[model samples]
Target: MPHDENSTAGRVATQERIETLEADTEIPAPDLDTRPPSSGATRQANDDLRSLEAGLDRLQTDPEHAPRAWQRFTTSVLPPILFVLALIAAWQLYVVIAQPRPDIVPGPLDVLAAMSQAWESGRLQTAVLTSLERGVVGFLIAVVVGTPLGLLLAEVKPLRRAVGPIISGLQVLPSVAWVPAAILWFGLTDATVYFVVLMGATPSIVNGLIAGVEQVPPQLRRVGTVLGAGRTRLATLVVLPAALPGYVAGLKQGWAFSWRSLMAAEIIAVGGTIGFGLGSMLQQSRELADIGGVLAAVLVILFIGILIELVFFAPLERRMLRRRGLLGGTR
Candidate 1:
């Protein structure tokens, strides 16, 4: 009886103490009428703030770093690659399906086989190297001759007025048109081919240079004058650099003309002395009645042209135009 009484009395005293503490703090007890929601509300707000911070971190970091390189490569480089593959595949398909006389359309496999055979026999490399050497040498000569001529045309108004139309017209003239005359002039020698190539290229290069000069801002010329640039110094430093892009364009056009002219001359005036260029190879294939060889030669011509354009002009043009801000960075 004494133990039970003491226990009951202690429980009453503990309850009274809890009631008194709750009253002093002005907070309801958990088991009583109600409890304050402040702690739960704070926890919820903290959770929301943490979630928002996490989201912002994700937004700022991930998109800029890893995928950009891949995106650029795919967007900039892949299309050309895919186009080339498609073109080759289409050519192969056409060759397979047409089943034309070998003289008319050679299969891709046949062309490749001939290429391989030519390589093994050492003739392909010899022919390619010979053609490349000729093209490069002829192109350099054209640049040397044409560039000065172009500058003259650009600076001298009377000369420009006299020859500007002719220069532009020369670009459209077929290189084949010069073959007969070139042969007549120089006969079967390489000099004849070189001469024709120079004739073919020179006009285009000159025109390009003239155009480039014309494009240079008049203010720049005024600036040069104020800086005490002499005629020669102005031409060399201010005008030439300003007109370089047009001059480069002329070179590209000139190369095309030179290549075509050489080919035409080689085909019409065949000789061992001419060596084996794409044109000579093509002529030989035609004479031999070998379609596969003809196709192979054609492919070689196209590939070489594209290679030279890409290697020399494309990048150079891009750089120049970009520097000038004329290209708008499309390349």
Candidate 2:
């Protein structure tokens, strides 16, 4: 009986000791309703995030912060106008100071007079219109041909490997270098001009599209595949849209090349039924020793290039950037 009682007492003592140890070592359950106090760094980070969100929201909603149409127009136009005027003034000053022969370095007024004469003779309009028509036609053909060529090159590795260096080499080759071959092939016709233009423009466009395709993230392709898109659908719908910026850059460069090639062809491929272009006018003036006429023709070419950029490419680029939210603030 005494032994049983001693054993029970020992068991009770052991139980009490376990309970005390557990009470000493146990951690309190975390409060579900109460959060820990934030540190200074955490509070500062939260404040910065909120500020950024508010700024973005204001940018989206506020019209007053955006530039007005007239403001934008003035900002774009005024600087160029001022620069032109300054250039004209400098040219006039140089003519007055140097007293160079009119045949060698004509004054701005002399060039203007030459321009007036050309205008009165209707040659200026004819030259501009002819060149513009050829340029537009050639550029359209290039776009049609190049877009597909570029896509194929970008998608097909073996083809790209075979032709990629050739394309790049062609781009580097002067468009003027092709004129002799083109003339020999097409025999001093509009076909020659178009051929040179195509040679000049197509490579740039193909390379551009290839570059754009390379820049497309792999994740985008995987996502399209997962979403049940075929190769064509993935390329057309996803890749093309993402590659637009590079493609547009290529297009702009292609047009420049086309214009330059056309000029070279017109200058060299003379004495046929081909219509007189700006280059033809310039060459004629040079042959006639008419410095004023040459300058006038050159100015007309410059003006046409500026006009096309302002009217078409600039607005197109701006719209694309704005739509993609890549353009921020008042453009």
Candidate 3:
């Protein structure tokens, strides 16, 4: 009876102590719940944070550890120049050491002298300008025709199926093959020259553009369609941009064809003021057995092509690759 009474007292004492402790402890009132920011506000905050990070990154990298411009010049620019100089030096050494007949291979000095003479005589400038004018006109015509033709062939399955092989075959066909037919049809006129140039260049350009457009990611096309772009708009904005590298390649080839065609016309169709160019000079030099003059003319031809590639096409190609991220980040 006493043990049971003691157990009941202990239970009563424990309950009273718990109640007293609860009364002494103050319960915290809940804070009013705040509404979350709207999606627009959240997006803005994230954008701000990204901008902050970008700025910080830029500042951190303001002082570059490596000289990028110098490195690019050394690796990309200097090597080609050095290689070409070395080649020229080697050629000069061979000429001096061998003392080969000038008719077979003229020395560098002899070629330079011939170039200097031609420059003073104004023949070099005249021939260069004449050839360049023809090339420019021919290449422009090729571009005007080729771009749309390529797009059409790429877009229309039936057209591509019908004309694809012909275009490819035309590219493999030498520009010189057309010269005889062009001469027969147009008879030594600028028309003949233009016909040959167009025949040679248009096919290469069209093929390049077709390849580029066809290679455009299908995902991009679908995306463009989903974004409400019409076929024409999609081609102009999406497909063309994606196919820029190939398009550039086409333009480069078109220029080359135009040059080759012009040279052929100049060589074969001499006498008219219209037919006067470096090819004419070369022909004349060869006929007269002026080995130095022949070499000088050849050098001028090579130099012009190289100069055009460097000045116009090289920069354009580099920009396209860089924009596409092909040449930007570390490899």
Candidate 4:
């Protein structure tokens, strides 16, 4: 009886202790209706945070923050113009100093006169148009052929191992070296020029794409795979976008190679159904011993190259870099 009474008292004491602890630790429910308003400093801090967010958003989207049109012209266009002007001035100064023979090295003014005469006769326009047409067509063809070939080579290890070195070798080979073989294969025709252009440009494009693929981070590929992207999707959506810089560089190089090859083939092949191009004009001037005409033709070629780079490749690369946040500033 005594043991039972002691056990009951112990249980009662423990229960009372638990109830007291619970009462002491109890938290009252917050009454939303009676809650005090936020302090002035808290409201001010929130406003400041919102203002900061708005400022960041404006910085991202505001056109006023970008480089102005005049600024862009000054930074990009003015420098090249100044450089060309300085070069022309230097050439003129050298001519005045040395007074070289007109047949050997015509002055810039003589070359300009030749260009003006050709322009008046419409020969310059025709030659430039013809050459440009050939170069564009050949470059387009190379892009069509090389893109898939490069993708395949980049994806396939065995194929790349077998053919990669050969492509590199071809890139190093002079475009002029292909002229004789192309002429023999296709005759003195537009086909001969196109064939040489293809030979010169295709390797550069292929190698470029391969190089780009190699530069793609392995982690990116893994991420694509994790996202359940198929092989084609992974390449086109993920790899290609990431590899754009190298691919664009390759395209620039390919165009240069195609232009050089077209010139070589046009110069060497000469006759048949081939239209008179800048190369043909240059050759004709050489044959006639017209140094001014030769220099004018060369100048036209140089101008065309610079124009294409400025109009096409430069903007493309700049846009790509800007999109990737690689460029230093907005333009």
Residue-wise lDDT of candidate 2 within 188-272, one digit each (tens)?
A: 7889889988998898888888888898889988999999999899998899998998888888889888888888888888867
Give a tens-digit lDDT track for model 4, residues 1-331.
4545665775554554443324324655566458644689967988999899999999889463667899998987899899989998999999999998878977889999999999999999999999999999999999999989999999999999998899899999898898887778888788888888998899989988999899999999999999999999999999998888889989999999888888888788898899999999999999999999999998999889888988999899998888788887763
Backbone clash pairs in model 2 (N, Cα, C under 3 Å; residues 3+ apart or in different chains), count: 0
Give me the runs in candidate 3 sitting further than 4 Å from their true place. 1-67, 328-331
lDDT of 1: 0.80
Best-to-worst ranking by lDDT: 4, 2, 3, 1
Query: Which RMSD does model 3 reach against the true structure?
Result: 13.0
lDDT of 3 at 224: 96
Overlapping backbone residue pairs in candidate 3 total: 0
Compared with the true structure, all predictions reach lDDT values of 0.80, 0.88, 0.84, 0.88
Model 1 lDDT tens row, 43-99: 798889989999999988744232355775697679988998998899888867877
Indicate the residue-level lDDT of 328 in model 1.
46
Error of 2 at 86 (Å): 0.5
> Compared with the true structure, what per-residue lDDT tens digits does model 3 show for residues 115-174?
999999999888998889888899899899999999899889998999999999999988
> What TM-score fits each model?
0.74, 0.80, 0.80, 0.80
Taking all chains together, the TM-score of candidate 1 against the true structure is 0.74
Model 4's lDDT to the true fold? 0.88
